[model samples]
Target: MLNIVLFGPPGAGKGTQSQKLIDTYSLIHLSTGDLLRSEIAAGTELGLRAKTLMDQGILVPDEVVIGMIDTKLKENRNAAGFIFDGFPRTVKQAESLDSLLDQNNTAISGMIALEVNEEELTKRLLLRGQTSGRPDDQNEELVRKRVQEYNTKTAPVAGYYANQGKYHAINGIGEIEEIFTEICEIIDSYATQLNA
Candidate 1:
């Protein structure tokens, strides 16, 4: 399976680009945020716990996320590939992801990380909050905190992937299409090698 990790901070256009990648590559989108939201909507036990942590901008426990991913992997065993978004935020989680994929006889082909400046991310998120009604985006303080948290806690995950030569950072400041084109180019390069 052509498993890919779409790595980026909040408001870095990961969600937006994921749709295009999904359409172009026919990859199943595995967004932890979406999964948690579904559970939250259903009022599942995991959702309730995740909600509390998310409300405080804290990442949900790794075990909970790993379990969730286990289910997703089993559910999508026949998929061509999977685009992992909003996951593996920490090095430990990345290690866990590696083992999980190994168990399924697949590995992350690449990790595409969007490199967006803090200023732009803040602007994009606050603007989105106006219409998205997302509590996290609606508050500038919370948004910055989330970004800071990513820098402190999540940025190292990039290094983990880089160590394995599976990390590609793309500029996230250009027009959406332009940024996506850059991402596609990187993914295409990786896909070609995998296929060969």
Candidate 2:
């Protein structure tokens, strides 16, 4: 399997690139945010628990996310690979993910990181918030906070993957297609080497 961890801060275009990678490479897109939203929409028990925390501006526990991911993995057991987005934000989460994958006899192929400036990200998100209607995106203060949280809490995830020689950085300040092409090149090269 060609599992990948798509790493980036908020508004780093991870959603855009993950979609392209899924379409082009036939990898399952496992977006934790989307999964949680689905669960909440469906009104599942876990979703209710998560919703309560989310309503109070608190994050749902990591184990809840891991369980959801575990279910996703089980459902896509025969998948070519999975492109993990909005997940493994902490080193602990990364370690748990590795352990989960190890139990399934597979491992993360690589962590594809998108490098974008905070200022640019804030601009993009503010523009998006105009139509996105997400409060976090609408408020510059919130957006900056989110970015700061990612840098402080989630940035170490890249180091974890780097230690395993499974981290690749791509410049995210270009045309969408241009960025996608670069990401594909990295993934394809890794796939080739893995098979060799």
lDDT per model vs. reference: 0.93, 0.90
Instruction: Give the Å error, residue 64, model 1.
Output: 0.6
Q: Please write out the lDDT profile of model 2 over residues 1-196, one tens digit for every residue.
A: 9999999988999999999899998999999888888888899998898777755545578899998899889998999999999899999999999999999889999999999999999999999999986666788877887788889889999999999999999898999999999998999998997899
Model 2 misplacement above 4 A: 55-57
TM-score of 2: 0.94
lDDT of 2: 0.90
Best by TM-score: 1
- Predicted structure 1, TM vs. truth: 0.98
Score candidate 1 by lDDT. Answer: 0.93
Model 1 off-target regions past 4 Å?
none
Q: What is the lDDT of residue 57 in candidate 1?
A: 90
Separately for all candidates shown, the number of backbone clashes (residues 3 or more apart, or on different chains) is 0, 0
lDDT tens readout by residue for model 1, 66-145: 99899999998999899999889999999999999999999999999998999999999999999997888999999999
